[model samples]
Target: MNFLYEKITFIFDPLHHFWEHEKLSRKISIMLVLFFVLSLLAIEAKRLGILTGPLFSFVPTNHFYAISAAFTVVLILEVISLVFTLPCSFSRSVGKQFEILSLILLRNAFKELSKFPEPLTFHGNQEAVLRILSDGFGALLVFGLLGCYYLVQTKAAEKAMRPTDLYAFVAAKKGIALTLLGIFIYMGLHSLTATLAGREHTDFLHQFYTVLILTDILLVLISQCFQPSFYAVFRNSGFALSTLIIRIALAAPPYYNVLLGLAAAIFAILLTLTSSRLFGKK
Candidate 1:
């Protein structure tokens, strides 16, 4: 167990250290933005023959592509934020995941827009129109639901614990965060290598959520050590359900994905509100 603990810490130390520095975090954010902008410019230039071939040729030249890229970066940052926030508040961390999923749906909607027929008419391309309508409206609905979640979440009070128990809980959560960071790094490298090798990449979102479900179950077990109330367990378990919904969404068609994902968020919010009223009333 000691060796395993040290290995986990070693894998996650950089992420742990990165969040400790506000300046470093800001610098990294700026660098990601700059990289995205430069990449878009490079891709556009290559498409126009101002740059050489074999660079981002797999990517198409479209404004939607830029939007997708930017959102992809945001999704990665949000996942990191979720890991950091989990140690502090599990509900809030789950909310961050909902936010990430909403952005992903929005990103896919933009991609659908890019496929719109030239001259853009409702005639003869009804399928594309329906896709855009479904994705766009679905994203809007999810975003609205997310706002409701925030309001409900604000009403949920934090559970008090003995200082020693709180310390142990936080430490355990941090260890889980480190493990997630390791998974993120490994998935990224796996995706990059697969892309370079001209092979189909793994569904990273699915994999991440699978790990997350197990992590949340572990967290629930750990919370038992602190003599958590019934509501605490229910809320944590609800979060696991939310993560499972997201994993399922990844394999679903766009329209169904949006509906299922939105339902999951709503369910989670309802659970939180119920827990607050029944057990967290002050």
Candidate 2:
């Protein structure tokens, strides 16, 4: 077990540090700007028939799609960040998920922009505008609620575990997180390939959330090994259920999606408060 823990740590620690580095974030920000500008120019070129051939085939010819593309890249970065949060306390990890959920909502709002005409006429844009409103406000609501979730969090439950058991639980989660990173890469590459092969839409994020649900369930079960107490198990399981709701929200239609996301966030907040109240006193 020690050997396995060391191996996982050796792989995860450096990668996490590099991923969290300020330099990398700056580089990615610059790249996102370049990507957005290049995408707009390329899209305009495609629209004007100046760019030809299969390389540009998958690229949409709308300038608004550039915004969507930028948001997609941002969402990908957020999901990568989410994967690194897996080794933390369940509540903290779930909080991170809520963060991503808000971003996803914002992304959906940007995606709705693609439906607008180039000159941005209001005619026939009512439904699209309403969808945008739903997504934008939904994102804001989730973002605000996330602050509450963090504010109510206490370390008492986590501190209740024995040191050795806590160590084992953390190591186990680290291994799982490392494995999740691998799966994330594979899914991303697969999605890209499928898109390049002319698949109109690949629901890559949705597929990944499905995998996350399974991972959350595994995490809940793994917590049983080190902290078999009722409160601990129930709390972890409730977090997992919250993740499942988030997954469902990804598939739901616009208004329904917003409602589900809010529901998930509220459920998580209530769960945290209940667990903290029940077990934190001891």
The top-ranked prediction according to lDDT is 2
lDDT for 153 in candidate 1 is 81
Give the distance in Å from residue 187's predicted Cα in candidate 1 to where it truly belongs.
Answer: 0.4
Give the residue spans of candidate 2 off by over 4 A. 154-157
Give one digit per residue, the lDDT tens place, for model 2 in 1-282. Answer: 888887887888899999999999999999999999999998989999998998779888779999988989988999899899898888888988899899999999999989998888888999999999999999999999999888888533454778877777888898999889899999999889988888766578888999999999999999888878787888899999999999999999989999999999999989888777777765
Over the full model, what C-alpha lDDT does candidate 1 score relative to the true structure? 0.75
87-130 per-residue lDDT for model 1 (tens digits): 76777777787887877777777667567544456777677677
Provide TM-scores for the models: 0.82, 0.97
RMSD of each: 3.5, 1.3
Please give the distance, in angstroms, between residue 45's alpha carbon in candidate 1 and its true position after superposition. 3.5
Poorest lDDT segment (10 consecutive residues) of candidate 2: 154-163
